[model samples]
Target: MALRFEELDFQPTPMGEISLRRRYDPAARQDVYEVRLGDEYLMSSLFTAAERALATLALDVLDAGPDTGPDAGLRVLVGGLGLGYTAHAALADPRVAALDVVEYSAPVLDWHRRELLPDTAGLATDPRCRLVQDDFFRRMGAAPQDRYDAILLDIDHTPDHVLHPSHAAFYTADGLRNAAEHLTPDGVFALWSDDPPEPVFEATLDEVFAERASHPVRFGNPITGGESANTVYVARGRAAR
Candidate 1:
């Protein structure tokens, strides 16, 4: 009998604890998980700077206004819990009264419990944190008990992703309209995109939100060293005009 040496599907990476060799599926015409590092970063992932920065900017916008009552109790709704960087940043803010993290994938949730996975258990287990394991839309459909000061979403790699077609609706005019319906007055809706969308989309946001603004942030040189551009959409959810 000889020792077996080819039965593994995942490998280890220097930056994170896990990695995998992607497999190609002819049916889906999509690459399987040949290799996957941390949700935070991937060798082929060039948007780390944008993702974290978007979270930071959203928090900044949420906390910009004058402080009110002693217990204003800031509440935040995070659409997707990636590596928990956004949640971690939110937890750092003392103003945040509660953090509602909605993640669709269970594997990602499991990983968060691990020490290598950014130690999200601290937030996950926090009394103020509520983990909802369901579709974002379904969760939103339920009447919200407490209106949030901010709603930050990063559900997909981009608006043009083929992996999840339904996600397209999540970024549509109607979708934004529903998002607006859920926000508290003066609250902002910040969406993360790999690249800026067409002007029509901004117009859609303006249709629902009062004040609209877009921020373009380029981080790291190799990606933006030559001819490249990336941005995030920061739209303040305004009351009906």
Candidate 2:
């Protein structure tokens, strides 16, 4: 279905078009995507603040390295490719050796390849990017042992706001155990949430990562603002053996 930008909240971007629908009822849902930015939400679209924090926090984790090589060459795994904000940010960093961006939505991928690539013009399609269309939770379990330098997540609005029930497993203590197996000790796992996670979720991270921290990103200020107070969870994995 061709999106009806006229009927939704329109936000101008350097790319094609982005619209948000805030009127969905109990059963109906909405998808939010940006013209030049990213798809912040699907059913509850229009939360770009959360997306930006997801990317920024991942980068911050990468920068907090005592053991990172002098070259800063690191492999990164980003679990969601909503509007490519995380991908774009990773590409901007000279420290990133490779970026594996996984997105499950085919239309979202097409829109990105067709609309975003042309509009952004090769800024994000660098040689370092490897876009994979797959379920992040499944991939996490199947990924090789201790492989990635960083794992950035923005699969849902928050740990509580799950779009797919299967994803709940990814937030469980056991799921984080699997995620830890995929990290290269000292590798970072950055998770973006619309709000601070539940106590159980926070505990799960503490149980899995060697170091755990949460950073709050503020939005909606004249000088530095956009939407809401997004939170980023930073967790470090054991060094790759």
Q: Who wins the TM-score comparison?
A: 2
For model 1, the stretches where C-alpha displacement exceeds 4 angstroms are: 1-47, 63-71, 119-121, 221-229, 239-241
Query: lDDT for every model?
Result: 0.63, 0.66
* Model 1 residue 35 CA deviation in Å: 8.0
lDDT by residue for model 1 over 74-97, one digit each (tens)? 778888776666677777777777
Query: Who wins the lDDT comparison?
Result: 2
The TM-scores, one per candidate, come to 0.71, 0.72
